[model samples]
Target: MAAPRVSVFPSPQELGPALAQLVAERAAGGGDRFSLGLSGGSLVGLLARDLPAAITGPATTGPAAPARWLLAFCDERLVPLEHPESTAGAYQTQLLPRLPGPPPRVLTPATGLPPAAAAEEYAGQLRQAFPGDDVPVFDLLVLGVGPDGHTCSLFPDHPLLQEEDKIVAALTDSPKPPPERITFTLPVLNAARSVVFVATGGSKAQILKRILEGGEEQPLPAARVRPASGELLWFLDEAAAKELNIPVEKHSVL
Candidate 1:
């Protein structure tokens, strides 16, 4: 596995724009369609605030628009679409309208269905969206790490962590709220072209240090997120990086 690139910013204010710029750069780089996997949390606010500006700003040139992107949730709470905890709903209301063009193709789980059925249906959606690949390799996946070292709905010591066969799995015992969710398994996560973990706040400091520095026998969910042949990155603010002893690139505009 390749070592992750760590970048620390002065604060979230600085981090947000940098994150948006990185997204714009990746969107401009290659194929006709760019597939992006999104994990919700504070990341929604950050991307909602900056991504639109980054793509529409006068400084931006080329075809870096979001119109051709395919956005999928890395994990989604099985709740009503209008529910406050729904990741897909958050982006629909907060970020989608802000973009300049028509909009990206977004893949949202069928929340009205039971958890197991939702997982099966969503996996089918992924297969159709990304034909020819046994496991869809996203162009980029933007993720976040919880204070407990969890990412997506996969919590510490959870059975879902052992999942390998399913590209997406459902869990009713998530340590976090809502009790149920569907998430992309390690196979899909590890096959991504690039994975960027954005973490901020002092509350995340200790876990960040452990995830970045410690090499445990049973790695934390966040730590287990090593993309097989893809780039892994950690975008942190100083408060989140305060406890880290590893070398990190201080932020400068991308």
Candidate 2:
């Protein structure tokens, strides 16, 4: 398939509003529910800010407000919620309190399990949340690309990239610290209705160029994310888009 639409912003500040607008449109559609998969990274903080501003502003509203929005982690470190590394914990600290509601349904791995068991338990939670024909199609999945071109917990040259049987897997030897993690497999990630990769920093510029221009699927885990029936979006800051061979535009302020 051809490369998905790529949008470059001068800064993450510009990207935030666009992300908010997209989420608002999808949520307003009034599907059975709006499911979102989130990643834990610096980008998420910006997303947290943008999301509330988009939904809470003085916009015209009808009786049918968006309801039943669910949030899940695209991947998480198998640590307790209190742990500094826990993805869910980070979201709670950075994004949750800003929103108006109690909180979106957050699916987290069962605590006190061994690494492998914790991952399995989380996968089971996903299955239960999205069962049989009712498998929830994610309205939006926010992701971050690591310096090594990894997305979620899937890393460069990791065996999980080749996994096909399971929708989620446990990683015991991640190149990054806090090796133990639970991550959505390619199949599960590709099933989303929309996938947006939020990558910033000059450190990622070269890999971003390679991923977009090289065109060949390499060892980079981020390259494996291809939504089967959904739109794929890349939200890149100027530094991250510097090496890309495509023209970019600055978003006008509203």
Candidate 3:
């Protein structure tokens, strides 16, 4: 396994802009489109602020705007688009409006189904959106770690951790509330071209320590998120990095 590179920032404001710049750079390269998977939490709010700042500029005379990119959810609650807990709803309310152009292609699950059906529908959506000889490689994936080290709704000590065949599955009994959710399985998550974990707050300090230095046998879910050949980065704040003894580099945008 490769060593984890942790980037410590003083605040989310600093980390968010850095992440947005990285995404823009990745998307700038020639490709059909950039596929980005996002997670919901306090992380989304920070992204809302940073992404617009990075992608948009002062209004100026122009013939046309740049082509919009694609946005997909790495995991989503089994709720309607209008539901309070809907991940897509959160992004629409927070991130989409601020972005320039019509809107990115937002992929979401077919609503009004049972959890299992909804999960299968989402998996089908992914397969269609990213058809290939093998698993689709996401351009970038932004993730958030729960206090218990869960990422993309995959909780530690759950049976979902052992899933291997399916690329996505319905989680019916998440340790956290709002149990019904659909998430990308480990195989799909590890296939991403880049995976970044945005973890902040002192509440996450202990778990961050465990994930970084704890033995593989006592692994946390966040510890298992290794990309096939892509880069893995952790954006942490001082409070969150408090218990981590490993050396972390400070980032500067200037």
Candidate 4:
């Protein structure tokens, strides 16, 4: 895995617009369609509040056509779309409204299905959207790391870490809540054209140190998310990166 390119911000509030700008930059690269993978957590709220500012395009050349943005989940709770914990529900209620135009296509698993069944169904949806035996590489992925260094639903010391064949896999008894879930496997996660982890808060400091400075032998799920042919970046707030030993570069949306 390559060393992550780090972007540090003084606070989560400042990090939001920078993250939004990065997405706009990726989308502006001229794709017929832009596929974005979104993970659940505080990122949901941050993007909802700040991403819209970058969406004011039509009048100016900013991003790929707003209508071409196809958002998908990296992992999701196995709950009804109406459920408060549902990631898709939260994005629909929160982020979509922040966009300047009508919502783009959103691919989500059928609610109430068994975890395994839901995973297969979601994988099928991905295959149909981006077909072929090779992994479906997303245009950009905005992710979050749990305090335990988990990304998506893949947790520490979990067998799912070695998962290679399936694009998506189901999980049960996750260390975190909403136990039953479906997640995009590492192969797909690592194949994204660009991957960024949006981490904030002092609570993330220790794990940030571990994932960024620890040896590869001691791999954390979040650290495993290295894009093979694309960019791997970490956007952190000062509180989240305090424990790191490495230097950090600052960024601007401008």
Candidate 5:
């Protein structure tokens, strides 16, 4: 696995646009269709604020067009679309509308079904969307690191962490709220062309140190996310990077 590229910003204010720029560049350089996985949390606010800003300009016909993108949530709460906890709902209302040209195709989990059934249904959606691959390989996956080192709905020390058979798995005990959720398994996360983890605030500092430097025997959920044959990145604000000792690219305000 390749080592992650760590970029530290003065604050999330600066990190947001930088993250957006990276997305724009990835979308511009990849295949005709760009498949992207998204995670929730503060990342929602960050991307919703800066992604559209970074993607500005007239929508021209090209591989980089937003119309060709496929947007899927890395994990989603089993709640009504209007519910506050719904990741899909947040993006629909906030991020999608702001992008230029025709909107991207979005795949959302069936919130009405039971957890196991929902996971199965969502897996079927991915299979249809990426028919050629046994495991769907997304072009870019935007993930977040929980203070507990969780990513997606896979919490630390959870049995879900051992999951390898399912592309999507359901969890009833999320440690974090809403309890029930469907998340992409590590196989899918590791299959991405690029994985970027955005973490901010002082609450993330200690765990960032352990995840980036400790190299534990049993790695944290976030630490275990090393994309196979793909690039891994960590975008941290100064507050979150305070405890780190390794070399990092320090970004300035644009």
Candidate 6:
């Protein structure tokens, strides 16, 4: 297990821009396809607040093709894209306005289909976007950690957590609301070039301790998100990092 770089911020407000800057820098490292996977919750709201500031002017003018970025969800609810709860809807409404140039190609699950079928359709979309039919390695994945220790739509103790063959899978009984969702499996998520977990609030403190530290009889789903050969970063607000021995927060950009 590699040590994940931990950046503790004084507030969620400050954390967002720092995270967006880190993402922008990574995207600037030269790639025509800047693949990014987004997760929902306050992460969407936070990015909505600060990501646009990071996207304007110099960031998009660089060699990296932010305009051609491939945007997709780490997990998305099985509902119409117009629905308030829809992950795709949130990003479209909130994050899209921040981009300085042409929008990234967005890929979403066919929400009209059955859960299992939707998962397959999403997998097909990934295969079509990425050549050679191997597991898709996203250039960057921005994720959120649930208090229950879940990431994407993979809940703790869920059967989908053990999914190995499929790049995407359906969850019909998510411990969270809406019940059904389509999510990237561990194979696809772990294959990402980089992953950043943005966690805030005191509600997340306990699990952050366990994940950043160690020693659980069974690892939580969020803790299992280890990239095979890439960087993994945890951007934590003071409330979220409270239980760890990490120093008290002062705002700083990575």
Ranking by lDDT: 1, 5, 4, 6, 3, 2
lDDT tens digits by residue: candidate 2, 1-254: 43578888878788888877777777666667678888987866787788777776432242113336678898888778888888888887887777654456778767568778887888788888888833446788889998888899998888898988777788889888897888888888888888988888799999998776655646478878888888888888888888887755556545
Error of 2 at 40 (Å): 0.4
What lDDT does each candidate get? 0.92, 0.78, 0.81, 0.87, 0.92, 0.86
User: Which one wins by lDDT: 1 or 6?
Assistant: 1
Over the stretch 1-254, how does candidate 3's per-residue lDDT look in tens digits? 35668999887778888888777767665566778889997877887887776666531112212254667888888888788788888998988888776667888777578888988888888888888735768888999999999999899998988888888789889878788888988888888888889998999999999998778685888888988788888999888999898989986544
Candidate 5 achieves a global lDDT of: 0.92
Error of 3 at 152 (Å): 0.8
lDDT of 5 by residue, 1-254 (tens): 89999999999999999999899888888576889999987889899999987777743345667898999999999999999999999998988888888889999999999999999999999999999899999999999998899999989999999999999999988888899999999999999999999999999999999999965998999988989999999999999999999999998877
- Name the 10 consecutive residues with the lowest summed lDDT in model 1: 57-66
Per-residue error (Å), model 1, residue 29:
0.8
Worst 10 residues of 2 by lDDT: 58-67
Q: Please give the distance, in angstroms, between residue 246's alpha carbon in candidate 4 and its true position after superposition.
A: 0.9
Give per-model TM-scores.
0.97, 0.91, 0.92, 0.95, 0.97, 0.95
TM-score of 1: 0.97
Q: Clashing residue pairs in candidate 4, if any?
A: none
Runs of candidate 3 exceeding 4 Å displacement = 58-68, 252-254
Evaluate residue 246 in candidate 5 and report its C-alpha lDDT on the 0 to 100 scale.
Answer: 99
State in Å the error of residue 176, model 2.
0.3
